[model samples]
Target: MKKQIYIVGLILFGLLSCVQKHTKDKIESNQSRIFHYNNEPYLIKGICYHPVPKGSDQRSFETIDQDLELMVEAGINTIRVYEPIDDIDVLDKINSAGLKVIIGFGYNQNGNYDILSGSFIDYVKKYIDHPSILMWELGNEYNYHPEWFNDDITNWYKALNESAALIQEIDKKHKVTTAHGELPDALALKMTDRIDVWGLNIYRWDNPSELFEQWEKVSEKPMYLSEAGGDSYMTITKQGYEEGFNEKAQADANAKILESIFNNREVCSGVTMFSFTDGWWKAGDTDTQDIGGWAPNSSGVPYDGTPNEEFWGIVDIDRNKKETYVVIKNKYKQTLTEY
Candidate 1:
């Protein structure tokens, strides 16, 4: 009867797995101008994740288990990735750990899988039923690059809107969003009517409160800060914070930034702060940590007022928690209880 026993065991395992499936929460943003998960008002306590190991330029999930443990510890509920994740096992691990993901697609990736090539929809259709998916984000601050779209940014917006509409048509369960630099202009908003939510990659010197007031005057659609936080390395000393890789600069700035975001919850959704771990590949050498890198509209980057791209992570290259990690954990945990 060994054959019979084996078949029974397989059935039992399948049943248990089905019972343990992660929450199949439907996400939407409506007239309320806030995200609702399972019809309950939801806030995205998220982090921008690109865990490229040292000595490499490619994103890797080899340390996903360790990464998830740290993410869970920080009370982060969502991971905002810059590219679609193709591996089913990685998505499974993230789902099993009780987390959600915002999959971002680029306008062009030299033909592989991007919106311009019409291949990004393939990823959407593939992962449409995956429980871990919170939203499908299109483009990351592409408005800053008109040159890429034949010297006309509206061309990019048209493509973005069209692609977003297609994804929504296919996956009615999830919202389609975009990470625009700063705030969208009247033309930008008009062109992107199909975009469900606006993700502003804002940097207003640790004080982004004013943007909410401006947004209220402009449009009522849901919005969130897709990238707002300081890097650890200071280009120059200002305020009372010292220069030279001071973790406190990042910590202090992020603390204030979080405060601004939460205080304006009525007009904005929660933030997916700058990042998870330091990306050594942003500048100079992939094998070493470099201090200098540039970003559009980054004159408001904390005390030093510079992007310092390589040092933006709340955790360092090895996944060691920085002072900012504790700040984020405390804020996110406290906010979770409130909701």
Candidate 2:
């Protein structure tokens, strides 16, 4: 009996060692402002995903199997979530499907493991060894909301840098990033020294080409388009495309946007289009699709100047592929071919 117990202990020790090595080997690094995975350049072919079903404001992975299948079909190698995944099984499923995740943490979520609560680090330490993790995203476009940070954006930046520093102290393997709205000013860049990568949620109409040179002048950290895409609904017919649930406008704008992104792979790492599916919960009633939701710097949102938040998904609520989905798949796959 004693011999058997010792053998079991040895087996357990070996399994733990393997987990540690696997986690360490998959570290993400920035070498001279270029993102590298396992020491090789990794251009992210990613999409923002938040599948909150109609009639519910809560995020869920109940349709994960189908979602993963569609994501794999689109040649998507990474997923950007607005919140940290609470389920290990979901992370395992995502890993098995050959996808990595950039997990975002909110500032405050009613004491449910948020930055303000200081419990966000708990989730970080728990998932530190998970192979599917690509980066820990601190916030999404929080710069636009200084009201939450005592009427000053600088305070938020300080907290962001501190959180990032803590994560680096705990997990030296993965990098930390934040989703800033558009290009960061010189001051914002200076304040976020601990950030490994910068994510820009840009919507400068269909042409974001000017941003590449602009970004190169400011910082040397890696950057990716954390959110860049158009919604399906056009409020007014301005650019030859008709208004009202126009998928063509979205597809066309996304095509141009993607072309610009891929064309400037030298400076920009890659893009994770605004979303994977439409959210019925954004504008009005959660049970029905709403037409009016707003986003900053979204005047370039195709024929319509307004962003109908419910229609931004590359896939509809039911998981039907929108025209933009094909546009993304082609561009993403072509990128794979080029590399």
Q: Per-candidate TM vs. native?
A: 0.90, 0.89
Prediction-by-prediction clash tally: 0, 1
Q: What is the per-residue lDDT of model 1 for residues 1-339, given as tens digits with 9 covering 90 to 100? A: 999999999999998877665322222324467866666666888999999999999999999999999999999999999999999999999999999999999988976569999999999888889999998899999999999999999899899989998987787888899999998999999999999888999999988999999998988888888888988988887898887989998999999999888877777789999999999999999999998998998888897988899999999999899999999999898763233
lDDT of 1: 0.89
Deviation of model 2 at 303, angstroms: 2.7
TM-score of 1: 0.90
**CA deviation > 4 Å runs, candidate 1:** 1-31, 337-339
RMSD in angstroms, all models? 12.6, 13.5
**Residue 156, candidate 1: how far off, in angstroms?**
0.5
